[model samples]
Target: MTAPSEAARYSIQMLISDWLLIDGTMDNHVWSAVEQPGGDGAADPDIARRPEVARLGLSVRRAGWDQIAGWPHDLEGFTTWPAPGQTARMSLSGAQWSLVVLALRYWADVDERMSDVDGAARSRGIATSVEQRLVSLGWSPATP
Candidate 1:
């Protein structure tokens, strides 16, 4: 298959780990999209997944590949929305390597936040709010 142009190759995956919202607030955690092990390991999959897709969030939505195409590509590189932020790290796998560092920054940021929230459970109030935010954001955990 032909490689997407430098333009087509550029993309971002919005990880919701930091924004996961376990009780009712941002989960304040970090995450990464590892290929289901055997699936990608170090190789790209037969079909590439969206970089901006979010899962297990109260407000973020699971973006389809088609939607990823429409995201802002003109930016200097990967950036978080509601911006004025820090850089996240990107762990590019086979096909994902097409995108550069700037595009991968947000993922790193999300992962960092998750690390902050790592601990015992909190009150349900925050949890409920997170759920509402997840729905508002368009994210529905795969099981729910």
Candidate 2:
């Protein structure tokens, strides 16, 4: 099997952030919609234009919760926390599904407990899991 594309790799990195994954199947393209504060519905224009974020092949928009992830759920995506109140929806193409599956596997570890009270513990678990998985995959962190 061939290697996954750069987009898939980047999507994995982006998923580490606190943004809910939005689905844009209707548009035939996946996009990210960030929910900001003070009645703001869109991502900060400046944030949306960031270089690294741009590299993920995503588009940002100002959307309400209903637009991001609500019923009538025909799209496929995941949602994260509410720091920037953004939802990222990167399109799945080629081998990106494997990374998504890995994300699902990771998320499954936390899906059991659905409450913010367990966030700290969950964060630690995710970090531990990722670190262990990475180490097993032959990755070594650089010494500071």
Candidate 3:
């Protein structure tokens, strides 16, 4: 794959550092949304849930970027944590930012969809099961 452009890298870095703030504890709602299976509404409902999960899944499936970085990689794509005494620092590339954006967007969409589904279910007096709720939001179950 081609490397991302410098402008794209900077834009993505700002998004992570300033907006998403991945270096810190992610917001509970954001985390919840990201960790759910409806984020991307993709065929692999399981993988579409969270960005980190998707990234790991992709890495393994594609056999690329396997050892490059871990979950919540720093701005510079390093796998190191952001505590004191760690000198490793690098900016996130455009591709990395794209993944992050995809996760965030997916989470946002799922969160909204869940809210709507819950509201509708409540109105209908239906105690929706998790699987049912996911299906209501357009997620298909894992195939045998």
TM per candidate comes to: 0.20, 0.27, 0.30
Stretch of 10 with least lDDT, candidate 1: 22-31
Residues 1-98 of candidate 2 have per-residue lDDT tens digits of 33324322212222324323321211112223233335463444655443433332233222223233433233343232333534334333322333
lDDT against true structure, model 2: 0.34
Q: C-alpha displacement of 134 in model 3, angstroms?
A: 33
Question: Roughly what TM-score does model 1 have, to 2 decimal places?
Answer: 0.20
Give the per-residue lDDT digits (tens) of candidate 3, residues 20-130.
222221243344435544645464545544675544334322322232234353556444433333222233443443343344444444545778654333322221232
* Distance from true location, Cα of 87 in model 1, Å: 19
**Can you write out model 1's per-residue Cα lDDT over 33-103, one digit (the tens) per residue?**
32344655354342244233212221222222123333334555435432443222222222222121212
Judging by TM-score against the true structure, name the best candidate. 3
lDDT of each: 0.30, 0.34, 0.35
User: In model 1, where do residues sit more than 4 Å from their true spots?
Assistant: 1-71, 75-129, 132-144
